[model samples]
Target chain A: MEHAVETTLTVNGIEVTRRIEPRRNLVDFLREELGLTGSHVGCEHGVCGACTVRVDGEIVRGCLMLAVQANGCKVETIEGLSDSGELARLQKAFHDRNALQCGFCTPAMLMAARDLQLKNPKASREEIRTHLSGNYCRCTGYQAIVDAIEDVLHG
Target chain B: MKAPSFAYAKPRSLEEAFDLLERPGAKILAGGQSLVPSLNMRLSSPELLVDITGISSLAGIQVGRTFRIGALVTHAQIERSAEIRKQVPLLAEAAAHIAHPAIRNRGTLGGSLALADPAAEYPACALALNATLVLLGRKGERRVPAGSFFKGLFETDLRTGELLAAVEFPRVERSAFLELARRQGDYAIIGLAGVADGSGRRIAFLGAGATPVLAKGASAASSLEQALKALGNDIDPPADLYHSSATKLHLAKVLLSRAWNTLSKPH
Candidate 1:
């Protein structure tokens, strides 16, 4: 079967057009087609949060979304969080607190935490724990991850 | 893993999506969090995927005396919905407990309901709240209550070419609560969610059966004691890898006890 849907999506403030398969995952389209490798594909089954990204102001697992589904939607990846050579404040907190070990889960963790904080600026430690429960970090640096979120939430 | 190659369509209207579904082997793409994984695993090999994201009519929260959630509403949409919180806090609470931020962000309420994972939260919420699922197909819309939604393990009564439009939850004077395994994003070993209308009660159990289990008869009990007793008689959880059917039933009983205790207590 073949589908030729010519559509344009404004991703991270950049408009791009593609005529592609509807079954193509958004993560693959981002990494393979658009060359946006910031969104890593881990546990494509949705267990790992490494594929996390923001779609139209919401954090979503890129691996699970179809590229065609994101038509006309705004997407923000880790690459979009920072402008030029500087890092976002949360990035600084993550580094200061040693939140990342393998660094594979950093982008997704950052994206999820960013959404969490945006929704609840004064989120408590338990709240952060409950919210971040969806993103799995195999390196077991959850304490540091929680600490990093705590720093941003409290300080 | 790359999903099997398939045709794609982004329908701008629900009518368009419905027309597209009329095509054979067409699958509706709501959030794609669940469906994509299934497709990649070769669990589903639909020839056409109708991306309903372009159908703006299928999104958003409709507030009223009761809450009606558009089928396309994401997990995040349910979690942050003020109308859901006010009308059915348990549904919001269950949405909050769904697999982490990323999964919730991409998972849709209708998709989850259609997927009908025995361990999924919305099923429990639906069972406990006695919610009605509104489905739209070539024949038009039909309503199925939560009790009849689950046919078996990972199965639903949804017919081919049918699109889930919304879920209507009847308002009730009650408090709600949920308890799941500590797997952290994984399906719970056992889950119990309930709604207590002061004296009467409604309890739904997950992880105890092939699908979300309900003890609706017990929900009408005049007291927690009666409800707890009736629940044991109503539920028949199946044995599986995580737990035996007996164990799950026992867990349901225990959780029902806990739910009753929580619901019967002061706010």
Candidate 2:
């Protein structure tokens, strides 16, 4: 077996320099190496959105990516969703509308939602559902999550 | 919870990336989503993992009479690309339906094509669009047509040390449709993407076979009924854990049916 190589990159607007195995998963790197555990690891096979995060302003599955691939790239985890310890509107909506249950998928979900809103600020309910259909929430049955996004969209 | 150790290489250039790729027991890390999981499962134990992310020149979208997309361009970039949206709407639609928002952000076009899952949308998009795949290695660069790209399940024409550089798709002013299952972030059990540009059409199916298979009959069909029937017959879907190839074949028919309807409609 080959050993992992060490490298550094930016995470959530902060430059994080660390030596890691070249093959270290972005999910593990974020959670274990960087200690940003907000990005959960669910299926690890990219089927579950629990490990979702943003790389260079785009939402992506952390588990599906390798840490080395993120070298010199800008990454945003659920931890970086807010500035100055304040939650973004989407976070508040998710909290207010009760969009989470186990909360394992919330970080990725919020990041994905944030990406969608960035692309289309006034996205319709159907558009949100269409864009967010990839992130799964087995606990909430998705109504509350959809409702949360709807509230934010309507507002 | 530790990954099996692997030697890592950060190639500074595309040539270096290709050189690293040519070595035995080497795997290229593009987006890393698919390759990392395979590594975690111990299904594929490559001794050396090439980090191509350092080669910044490989990431970008080039629009032209025939658009050339760098392999490193992420799915999110493609989905949000105004040029791709205007020129290759089917590709955009397919990219939009990929795993999830976060996955799209990191997953690269080249990486996904290299992974070559039967159910992935990019391969099917490539096939439907008749894209050209550009490969780099110690020798030089070569372009492979979409039809010849996939060799089998989880396989492609990629050599041990070769790197995929870019995918060139012919710009088509046509109507298209993409339809698939909602296993929600799971690989599609079935997917259909059809491109129709007045004179001829092309239909591609994913998750229905060992590789991305083109239903050329559907593309060759001059009428809607013929196109649907061609799609139904052309797809020899293989049975997997998700759905039997027979069931997927039936689903392929339905998906192509919808795609054909949308494409053949008077616009």
Candidate 3:
């Protein structure tokens, strides 16, 4: 069977179409095809949240969704979010709190944090911890990450 | 790691989907939360991926005599739905325990039930609530009770060329869902889903066996102490890497006691 399929979708605010392999995941499509490398790929089996991105206004594991499956969908990566200035406050807070150590989990952490901010701005400390539980940050022991999100939520 | 090469198709209707399923090595793709990971890990490789998310008929929540949830309903949708929170709150509570926000945002109820992971939250909830699954096929539709639907680990009665269209749940006012995991989003080491109705209590456990195990001995017991004792007869949970069989059974008792207290209380 032929593996490549024509897929068209909007990234950030631009619509792009490409003929890609059906097995290529959304993260790879964003990085290799569109030259958007903000979303990192780690533990490709979906255990790690490094490949987190927004699809149709909801955060999802990029590796868990195929590029062909995202046909006609709207995708937003960290670069798009950063350029939009929507993550300014959270990014500042993360910097202020030194939330990142190795910095590998920053993009996904910021995405998950922003999601919580939009959905529940008044989220408690426990809620912040729980919401970010999926995004693994082996550095700073997650204390500073939680502190950063809390600052954005209540600061 | 990346998924092996495969053809893909997104069918807009069940008829079209069934037609695609006729192809050799065709596999249904719902949320792909579990399937995609397996693909990436080389655990499963199919010739064609039949993306069923485009099918409109298989997505929604309907409330009548029984609460009906479409197979395409995502876990996040279930967690945030006011109707599900009101009618079948156990499912809503259970949904919150499934993975984390991102996984929940993409994982579907039908996908979870169809996978029948034994450690997943929906199967035990379905068993506890005595839910009925709606299976659609080329021939017609068939309704299977949750008790009979789950065959074993990562297995279900879902037949070849058939799709789990929806699930019908009879509303039970009193129910409790609890699980013990090392972390918030990790799979439960042991979990309990309990429901109390006029008939009596239906207690089901996840991560306790190859399939969701109904604690018949405990459900039939009249008191908490007796129920705790009877639980021993109901299940013999296999040990995982981190826990021993004895430890799992002990944790199962702890959850049962908590659920028993909650269900026994006057509503």
Candidate achieving the largest DockQ: 3
lDDT of 3 by residue, B95-184 (tens): 999998999999999999999999999999999999999999999999999999999888899989999999999998789999999999
Q: Across residues B159-183, which tens digit of lDDT does each residue of candidate 2 receive?
A: 7667898999987757565656655
lDDT of 3 by residue, A49-133 (tens): 9999999999999999999888999999999999999999999998999888889999999999999999999999999999998
Q: List the candidates' TM-scores in order.
A: 0.91, 0.89, 0.99
Question: RMSD per prediction, one decimal?
Answer: 2.5, 2.8, 1.0
Docking class of 2: medium
Q: Write the per-residue lDDT of candidate 1 for residues A1-155, one digit (tens) a residue.
A: 26756667877789999986776778888889889999899988787778888888878878788787777789877788765322377899999998999998888888888888888989999889888887888999999999998998899
Q: Candidate 3: which pairs clash?
A: none
Go through the candidates in order and give each one's DockQ.
Answer: 0.70, 0.57, 0.92
From the highest DockQ down, the ranking of the candidates is 3, 1, 2
TM-score of chain A of 2: 0.91
| Candidate-wise lDDT, in order | 0.80, 0.79, 0.94
The alpha-carbon deviation from the true structure for residue A18 of candidate 1, after best TM-score superposition, in angstroms, is: 2.3
Question: Candidate 2 at B58: error in angstroms?
Answer: 2.3
Interface RMSD of 3: 0.7
How far does residue B86 in candidate 1 sit from its true spot (Å)?
1.8
TM-score winner: 3
